[model samples]
Target: MSAVPLEAVVIGASAGAMEALSALLPALPQNFRLPVFVVVHLPPDRKSLFAEIFQAKCRVPVREAEDKEPIRAGTVYFAPPNYHLLIETGRSIALSSDEPVLYSRPAIDVLFESAADAYGPALAGIILSGANEDGARGLKAVAAAGGVTMIQRPDEAQAPDMPLAALAACPQAHILPVAGIAAFLQAL
Candidate 1:
């Protein structure tokens, strides 16, 4: 099968996210050319060092996503602790204090749904290890938009609820272990 050219990638993770992200981020080649957007559940009342931690370990630049910021290829943008991250029609980012989805403020569904709408067939969405079912509908949205969808193999996930839920919601999503995910993305 032919591979679709991707403009961007979006990832969602929660419980056990740190270890999973550490394994996945370093696998991206230094020159890999796509903007990566990520949302990981964090307490709304606390500050998060998610970007800083990943930036220190990842080959690509990683930073907190800012409103109206133009997404550049090869950079990683993390949704801040208390806001919902959305994509604007102009290809910029917008953060909202909208009510949480699935009990998380920086909901994966919020980011994935908006991104799928903005990027359509050129987007790729990934649902990683998490304790909740938050990313299920969002992965379905990505697939419905003709974007590629990937789910961490349930057996390989530290907390499989998120991946299993995604597969149930979008059965066609490619199921891969963390290592396979890294390789598949590098191949893209």
Candidate 2:
């Protein structure tokens, strides 16, 4: 892991997430180097076509996570519609039906916590548009673990609550507009 510069990147988004992700994913170039792990709030009990939608626009491969499946670089995984995706050693994922946090099954905290423990400072965590406080604590945990934290500027967010909560909780978070965020990730 020490040899990998940045071990992995994690992202959390909700509410107006679809729109925010649509912009960010397409901005990442083909052959982007790092692995990306994401958590997006979705209505449980309904299957999402998000993976397919993103796959078409993203240069990186995208898939719905399968239990115990190993994570891989240049590929994006969406937590199964009703399940929370968790991290494990070297690319593997764990699925859970445990109760929702902040009213979200695939809660941002779950993904951010697991990724923080797994990657530590080698991690980069991003919080985008949303309507709740789901990702705030998780982003804080990531920063406390020595990782870089980024939040979409509240003014630019389609739903500012999430980003505002995140900034309030993680004061050090780098607040950037959507396009600035896309550019920052590209530079990394």
Candidate 3:
């Protein structure tokens, strides 16, 4: 665990995102103190229903990230389909239509990297189940910025490539199962 008090959390996922997120997000208590930013690779052709779905299960507020929105504590913001979600230096949300990274428009790297810049050591970055290596570099950036970095144990993930890649890039990251990750967030 990080000694620095965390101010925000950034989570990235792909292939098995829905299942992994289901196990994680609903665990946060309604009064959880930090803002949570999530980027799950979604088809660029459709609108994201993540906010609607998670809002029904989570105690905290859940909504799609909107451009230029202020970051608020106890809220879960999911990137809209086709847009890269970024955290501004001013602690606000910024959505971008930048070209896809790793074939995904709402790239995990963009979110994690920008968040690391914005929150520095006050951030916690988590990599979950996914089939690609999109988040590896971003998790490394988080670590470089003195943020806490975590990855779901590869053996327990439905899609292990992402976690495995992140582990390789950031050997120091905490490796935990989904339930353990949830417990860590709840205790924050």
Candidate 4:
């Protein structure tokens, strides 16, 4: 049985993400509470140090995703810089030079949409500070799948375009500040 109340968490960040992730990560207990998947836009062909950096600060194990890996609790899964990370029973990390949807390869929408299909009501999708409007439709899919959804308050975002786009897509989404977001996850 999972120690965390929720079955899964899917978080997406881009612009101003490092700071936002720093704030949110430590808020969870060292043992953490659930399976957390994150997609942060990064340039292809670059060696992303994000997983290493985050693993240091977090109590839970963290790694760049590998295709066909089974989901486990208390672990953080990050999309590789170039691949679109997706959950389909097995967490799939697929690399493609294909055109960027909404201009991102490790696109937030792709992750959330696949996760919605895989985990459905067990998922919680979070949209954080970002430059592009990548996560909105994915977050919408999460809601349609009976999952919980949250968007950072556009006003509080470093680049409000992402969260604002999410709001425009799913007006019923819970808009929250940075501090309240972790607590909201805890409540779930």
Candidate 5:
């Protein structure tokens, strides 16, 4: 069992996210109690079908996060295409149109940092395959806040830059392959 009593799990990815998530999300046990938030880079002008696609595959509830929506355990929330998703002090979702970070509107850094503040030591942040360095600092913030941090092993990632950047920024982050990450979450 995990020592942290994780209240939330935050995941960030870019280029190769869909496949990685396909391997990860469907594996969570149906009774898993922690809320999960995900940020995956995508074109802002397009509509997102992430919720529908993942919901069809996952045993747990999956939906696109809405502004002011209450954060609920046992559900997985995905940031919409253009909005930067945040967790407010009241534990409600906040969507922003603020200037994009790292050339991405739904930046992973935004979600991970906000969650690190909201959940503190009870949060777990995971950085996966991507071509950019967007999530590195946010993962560091999670670790600094005493939350658990993880990175998909670089060599195993479909695009290793994001994981490598995260590993460089937060050397202590647990390094796991995608399947290993799923197992770890199940164990938690």
Candidate 6:
């Protein structure tokens, strides 16, 4: 941790998102205080079952993010399919139907970058397994804003491209296995 009290967490994952998130989200204790915002690449035409799926496994409340909703502590908010999830300056959720980034609507970069702007040093950004380089710049933005940045170890990822790109963009990020990342979040 950067000695700055973290107010929120932003996590981006793809390819093996379900497995990676399963290992991480379920580990947060029921009393975990920070609100976690997650973006997992999903087909634009399909409905996202992420909130329901993770709700059963996680101790915290899990729900699909709603536009203009106030952020709540200990909640896990998953970006809705086909929309770009953004963190507003007022700490509220904003959904956009804007053109996709890196070929994904709910791009990891979109969420991470917006959250970095909203929380700055009080943010923690995490990049996990994916097939594309969507999160590299976002992780760099978080680091530049003095926020904590973490990436799953490339060797442990189902698809290493995302992690590798992030590492190349922001070498200062903590590189850890899924289990190690889980433990770090639990200690926060």
Report the lDDT tens digits of candidate 1 across residue range 126-186. 9999999999999999999999999998888899999999999999999989888898778
How many angstroms is residue 69 displaced in model 4 relative to the true structure, after the best TM-score fit?
1.1
Model 2, stretches more than 4 Å misplaced? 1-4
- Please tell me which predicted candidate would have the highest lDDT against the true structure: 3
lDDT (Cα, 0-100) at 81 in candidate 2: 80
Per-residue error for 18 in candidate 6, Å, reads: 0.7
Q: What is the lDDT of candidate 3?
A: 0.95
By summed lDDT, the worst window of 10 consecutive residues in model 5 runs over 1-10
Query: Candidate 5, clashing residue pairs?
Result: none
Q: CA lDDT of each candidate?
A: 0.91, 0.86, 0.95, 0.83, 0.93, 0.94
For all predictions, the C-alpha RMSD in Å is: 1.1, 2.1, 0.6, 3.0, 1.1, 0.6
Candidate 4 lDDT tens digits, 21-139: 88776576766667888999998889999999988987778888887777777788888887788887554444444567787889999999988898777788899999889999999
lDDT (Cα, tens digit) per residue for candidate 5, span 1-188: 23568899999999999989999999999999989999999999999988999999999999999999988889999999989999986788999999999999899999999998998888899999999999999999899999999999999899999999999999999999999999989987
Q: Report lDDT (Cα) of residue 90, candidate 4.
A: 55
Steric clash pairs (candidate 3)? none
Residues 32-149, candidate 3: write the lDDT tens digits: 9899999999989998889999999999999998999999889999999999999999999999999999999899999999999999899999999999999999999999999999
Model 2, span 57-95: residue lDDT tens:
888888898998877877788887888888874657888
TM of each candidate vs. truth: 0.97, 0.95, 0.99, 0.91, 0.97, 0.99
Quality of model 1 by C-alpha lDDT: 0.91
Off by over 4 Å in 6: none
Best-to-worst lDDT order: 3, 6, 5, 1, 2, 4
Task: At residue 147, give the lDDT of candidate 5.
Answer: 92
1-188: candidate 6 lDDT, tens digit per residue: 78689999999999999989989999999999999999999988988999999999999999999999999999999999999999998999999999999999999889989999999999999999999999999999999999999999999999899999999999999999999989988998
Better TM-score candidate (2, 5): 5
Pairs of residues clashing in candidate 1: none
